[model samples]
Target: MEAGPRVLIVEDDARLAAMLRELLQSEGYEVSLAPDGQRGLHLGLTESFDVAVLDRGLPVIDGLDLLTKLRERGVLVPVLVLSALGNAADRVEGLDRGAEDYLAKPFDIDELLARLRVLRRRPASTVPVIRFAGGTLDAANRVVTRDDGGRLALSERETALLERLARRPNQVFSREDLLENVFADADDPGIVDTYVHHLRRKLGRELIETVRGIGYRMGAAP
Candidate 1:
C-alpha cells in the first residue's frame, strides 16, 4: 500500500493533540505529535512531514520562534499555525514568519482537515515534471522550461500557483481556489492575479490562459 502523507502536530494541550492525531490517522495520515516547541522543533527539523500544525503557546520555545527557526534553517515544509491567540496582528505575525496557514483555537476539526488538504496542495510537488503547452514545469526544482528551451526559476508562491494549475491541465481555477490552496488566509485574493501575471511573464502568456470572466487554466490559447 502507498504510504499516507506524514503530518507533524506541535501542540501543548495533551487532549487536543491526541484528538488531532486520532482524527488525522483515521483519515489515513501518518501523525506525530509534540507537546512543546522544543520537541516539536526537534522533530520538525529531524523528520519529514507534508504538513506541520503548530500551536503558539509552548514551553522551551514558542510557536512563532520555532517557526522562525524552521524557516531560518531553510525547512520549506508547509506549516499551519494553531493558536488561541486569535487576532489580526497575531495572524499577520504568523504569516509574516512563514506559516503557510493559521487557525485560531476552538477551530472545528472539519475546518482543520480542509486546511490540511489545502496545505498539502500548496507546496510544489517532489515529482519529476508536469508538462503543458509544449513546455514543462519542474515542481521539484522550482524551474519552468519554455517551449523554446528557455528556463526560468520561480519563487515558492509562483511554484505553488503553477503547480496547482498545471497539474490539472485545462481545468480553470478561480481566485478563491488559488488563494485557498496557495496562500494564507491573511493574504489578499488579488495576490492570486498578481502571481498569475508573474507566471505568464516567465512561462509565456500562451502557457497560462486567462479564462476571462473566470480565472486561469493551464494551456496555450489555440
Candidate 2:
C-alpha cells in the first residue's frame, strides 16, 4: 500500500488501549483509540481503520456482539479479535462471527503486529476507480479525494462505506451491509444510521439516496 495502514483499538481497559495505540503508531500506523464499545462503534463506523483490535469484554456492548454486528452490517474490513477469552470454544465462535484472527490477552505486541501485517497484506480486487458526484474514489487505495483538492481526509471506515456503496451505485445496501462494510467490531445496529449520516454529510446528501423502508444507495451507477 502507498500509505500507512490505519487501525482502531477498542478496549475498555484504558491502560491497554493506550499501550496498543502507542505500539501500533510506532510501527507506522495511523491509530485511533476508543475506550469502550459505544464510542468505539462511533469511531469504527465513521473512520476507516484498515483493521481493528477489539477486546471481547467491553462495557455498553461485549466483543462478540460487536463482531457479529460488524459482519451483519457488511463491513468488509478484516478484524482481529483481541480478547482474554482464549478458550477453544470462544475462539472458534469469534472466527465464525467474522474475525480474521484472534489474539488472547497477555499477548506479545510483536505477535499482534505480525498478525496485523498479514491482514493488511491481503489483496482486494481492483475495480475501476470510481468518480461520482464530484469526487474521485480510489477503490483500491480506499481513499476519496474531493474535486476541491482538499486533503484526502477519509478515515478507513468512511472510505470502506463509500467504496462499497459507490462500487454498486444503483444497488441498495441495507444497514446490515453497511455495518459489515465499516464496523468490523460487532457494535450495535443503531450505529449503522450514525455512520450513514456522517457519510452523507461528507459525500453530499444528494449523492447517496435513502430508501425509507429499506436502506441506502448511491444516486446512480458509476
Candidate 3:
C-alpha cells in the first residue's frame, strides 16, 4: 500500500506528542515527532512533509521563532500553529509569522484533523515569494537573487532579520522590539545593531534604514 501523507508534529509535551502521533498514525498520516523547537527546526529544514503541526511554547527555540526560521530558510511546508495563546493578537501574529492555520490548545481532535486536511490540500504553488526593489528572496532556496542574476546567501540570523524588515516595509521596528521578537534568546540588544551592520555590508547599506532615534526599517532594496 502507498504511504500516507507525511505529517510532522513539533510538540514538547511527551504525553501529548505521543498521543498525537498515535492518533495521527491511526488516521493514516505518516507522523514524525520532535520534542523541542531545535529538533523541530532541524527536521523542518531537512525533511520533506505534506504538512506540519507546531506548538507555540517550545524549548531551545520559541514556536514562532522556529516558524520564522523555517520561512526565512525558504521552507514552504504548510504549518498549523498550535498554541495556548489563542487571543486575537496571538493568532494574527502566528499567521503573519508563517502559520497556514492557528488552533488554540484544548482543541478538538476532529477539528484539528479537518484543519490539517485543509492545509494538506493547499497547492504548493501558492507559496508567496518575498521580493524587493533590486531582487527577490528565493523562497525555494535561502538566497537573495539580484536582477542581474547574482545570488547572495545570507546567514540564518541575517535572513531572519532581513525577512522581518522586508515583510513590513512601511513600519519602523525599534531595537528593543527587534531584540524581543527576532533575537529572543540573546541578552545583548547590541546584537541587533551588529547583524544590521552585517546585512548592510553584505546586501548593501541601503537595504536597511536606521531611524535616528527610533530603530530600523526596510530601505530601498539593493
RMSD of each predicted structure:
12.9, 8.0, 5.3
Number of backbone-clashing residue pairs for each candidate, in the order shown: 0, 18, 0
What are the per-residue Cα lDDT tens digits for candidate 1 across 1-222?
A: 999999999988999999999999999999999998878877865688999999998888889988876664345789999999989999999999988899998899899999999999994534557787777877767788876778889986788778777778868988777765565432477899888888877766777787888888887732
Give the winner by TM-score: 1 or 2. 2
User: Higher-TM-score candidate among 1 and 3?
Assistant: 3
lDDT of model 3, residue 113? 93
Question: Global lDDT for candidate 3?
Answer: 0.86
Query: Where is model 2 more than 4 Å wrong at Cα?
Result: 1-3, 125-222
Using lDDT, give the best candidate's number.
3
The lowest-lDDT stretch of 10 consecutive residues in candidate 2 is 67-76
Candidate 1: stretches off by over 4 Å: 125-222
Residue-by-residue lDDT tens digits, candidate 2, 1-222: 566888888888988888888888889998888787777676765577788889988988687787665543344577889988999998999998878899988898889989999998877424466776667887556667777875465665666677677767778888986665555555698877776777777667776788998998887321
Candidate 2 local accuracy as lDDT? Answer: 0.75
TM-score winner between candidates 2 and 3 = 3
